[model samples]
Target chain A: MATELPSNIKSSDVLTDQTSSKWLPPGLALQKVDERIMTLNVGPQHPGSGHMRLIVQIDGDYIVACDPDPGYVHRGEEKMAEYRNYITNIPHLERPVIHDSCNVLYPYVLGVEELLGIEVPERAKYVRVIASELNRCIYIMYWLAIYGIFLGHSTMFMWPAGDRELLIDLMEKMTGARVTHAHFVPGGVRNDLPPNFEEVCLRQVAYFEKRIKEYAAVFYDNPILIARTQDTGVLSRQDAIRLGTTGSVLRASGVDYDLRQKEPYDVYEELDIHSNVMKEGDSYARSKIPWLDMMESCNIIRQALQKMPKSGSVRVKLKPNPKGKGLNTVYKRVESGRGSLGCYIVSDGKPEPYRVKLSVPSFRNLIALPYLLKGEKLGNMPSVYWSLNYWPVEADR
Target chain B: MIGTATGIIRALNSGIKHLAIKRFTLRYPEEKLKFVGDGYQFDPSTGVGIAGLKGRHLLFHDHCTGCQLCSIACEGVAEAIAMVKVPEEHKQNKKAIMPQIDYGKCVFCGLCVDACPFYALYMTNDYELSSFSKEGLIYTPAQLQVKPYVAQDSEIIITSRGATHG
Candidate 1:
């Protein structure tokens, strides 16, 4: 929703004559006013909208009508899938949600493997679950990190990224690359752990638990953050679904539709998911969901570590004729850090995929912004939007 | 009912508190932060990629086994990485593996790494590959080979520990 609309929009609450009610476009139920006001266009470049620009017609600071403009960074990602081979897309797709690379690419690999009928090994499943949960922690860490600034809890923002680096180091040890870990493949993973991975992982998990409390001390305890986020931008369960909000936002709204619970991918089914259901769908609840989710992510990682087989092939043996038996195509949708990352892959009896289309999560969630921001003050915009953690690249991709 | 003075005071108090507390900013050039282990690899002049560092294309020399299989398996997108075999001297028994990287046209995909049986080449994180002249990007065998691998003093540990250093 990164539309850079012009500031030429008439701001006044679209004041109508005393006699009749004419057509006023879909923003607010046109506010009853007398004089016309100047409409201010906030972002494609503005701070509040992140990467999105809203055509916000405002009277003073209160918004009259808001329209979100999108497709600024659309690099034809789905179209690129048609051109790229099956495995090559792991890197291409990973770039969008760079923080949550494993989660984004998990379903893509799952979808492709399901199509090729290549059963990914058990050790690989454990690896995938661990990697995905670690990615979630990193992503949520950034979410709280930046949102901390919006709420004026500066340390919360910095602390999470610094701590998240520990997990990033762990990922680096597992897969050679840090952010873009090309660990997930059609059959299984690229390689196995480089020894002492289990010990290092447990230590980082405990360290994260210690660091997450500092988040409470800095941000949660601070009254400014509490005031700004607690009840601001509230969405009831019905409103949230109608707005198509998912992930922490939906969890905040108390809908509790975590894909980890619903369509349990990898080792998620075996591990008990901790759903942080906040009755209040406010920014505070939304912000808190990820912190709690971070703990759950650690728990899942621990469960995965315990559940992992003693010694087996991390990567399934690469068959000479990979596209053997049949070339059945299937689409698999799994929840990523952003939201639902679904891959629709088609195979046509060749080594290369006939077509691949990725239904990214951020793009879906970006549409929910204008609905939430109807009557809210301009000041609370950064806090609300920051909590959303809209990866513009992921949305535009 | 929020006053302008109150807002300003709150903001000022917060800013002062942040400064009073441990300043999170790294003072990047002056007081550098310690890089945990290995930072993303790179060189100044030539942007040659190392292992798994998704560069535009890979270039292999006399070490390449004459299996043009890499180019053959390159699907959908035209084979950006080509294994052109030019047999110079068979004295050492390995064929002259002359690899050309057309940076003008390459996706920087490490497919060749996955494809190569010999594990002859890989990608590094040197992605500052901008050039005024187009000719600089068209990498030759000697250009790509790890002979005089532009050895750098990254000032990593030194820069971070410099203030404390004697």
Candidate 2:
């Protein structure tokens, strides 16, 4: 249906000055007209916003423009890495996205190993895959929980948050920490798995898979959510690629690009990974893809556990204060929970790195926010925004 | 109207089903998690630290040589470990300087445990180190020597209904 403007309305009338005469000079008189539009700053302190603000301009119920203002939680992680030595940087480097610490540190570990010319053991690769997949579900559950509350579904928030502990419990048993595992390192993982880890992991993950399937009835397939989200902030295939969006935002628009399948890292090439894609490219599709990916993650974890060698070392013995080859640089990218997280390192043959740069997916995916939000209803702001899977701290860092 | 009604009912049904399921939260302070090993320890022979939670640092006064390796290792990371002058006299610790860890700044990454060539520094499962004062949190060399008492027996049990940490 085409929206036709009233014949009596003129283009200049829509842009009429509304300032009072007291605020302007005597010679310049302000026009008196009824105000139909208002600006809303939803941000920084709002529960719906994750440390960033959205400058929204709404005309009646429709939003005219939405500008995403980021960089509220920036701590300059890349700058801090230059001062610390290779081994010491791990703890602080994973702080940007603590819940998804393994994946955030994956590309950094890969790049550092490349610079040091260390070959990881076969068992370590399989262990890394399991840990990465587990961390993926943990991070996604947290995101989904917030996505639920943003859409006024309180039960959706509670269930995902509760079930996420199953994965976090397994992570704690395996890597020692609940969220910030700091498990991945330059040569390999920090330590080997605990005894009877396989059985415990298998049991918890199987239950977790069962729990996530129940979300389909409650959150994903609900008619109210579909009405509020579907066709509201639609992004076509051309715009998604043209805007340089990554992860679920890109995949929701019928793009079948998943870095795990395309540029396979570690044991990803050995394992079978099915990239979840949807053609709708609305808020619903963006939200549904992550749930599909969580199921795929469970499948990948089961495959990794069955194929993993029974007994072997998880960490390679690295010399104290290990340094890279002189004046060399390396860039590595890994498929993280948010999207493709890449790390670029330039080593100067010293213990400390020369420079480090992170190409975070949250910042990349945020580019499409303003594009999708324009001309959308004001009520659909939270549904459209949170569905993009934007992590503020990671993006700002 | 039928589709909407069923959708709401289905969602409510899922929520109601979980009400019969047990809670997954661990009642902390009263109940701590049981770890697999005693603590995270490094063997010089293997050159790899064993798998465990990186918690409070436990210093072995007898094994410490006042080497300052752990303090040096923590410089770029947390700067929580400091080499301070000690009054006691020992053959190994000739310098009379021992490492004092301030828990305020520690990230508990356990890099210091890996840096100790001698089996002097290791991590224990005692994570409950909360204190009233800032000075109380700074564990001295003598304080680190004493082992912490921790009682943890909780584990996640999966049942026909659901999973719970008990």
TM-score (2 decimals) of chain A in model 2: 0.91
Worst 10 residues of 2 chain A by lDDT: A25-34
Q: Each candidate's interface RMSD, rounded to one decimal?
A: 8.6, 1.3
Q: Give the per-residue lDDT of model 2 (tens digit) for B1-166.
A: 9989999898788778878889878888787788768777777667767877777888888899999999999999889999999888889999989999999999888888888999999988888889999999999999998888879788788998888887
TM-score of chain B of each: 0.53, 0.95
Q: Check candidate 2 and list the clashing pairs.
A: none
Error of 1 at A227 (Å): 1.1
User: Candidate 1 on A1-397: residue-level lDDT in tens?
Assistant: 1222235546454454544344334553444443665566666773522366667666677665667776666776677766666766666777667778888888888887777667777887888888888888888887777777666766665667666667776776666566777667788776666566797688767666765764564566556667777777777889888878778778888887888889988777888777778888888887787888888888888888888997776665555335623556788888777667788878887766777777776666666777767778877777767666577777777
The number of the candidate with the highest lDDT is 2
TM-score of each: 0.77, 0.92
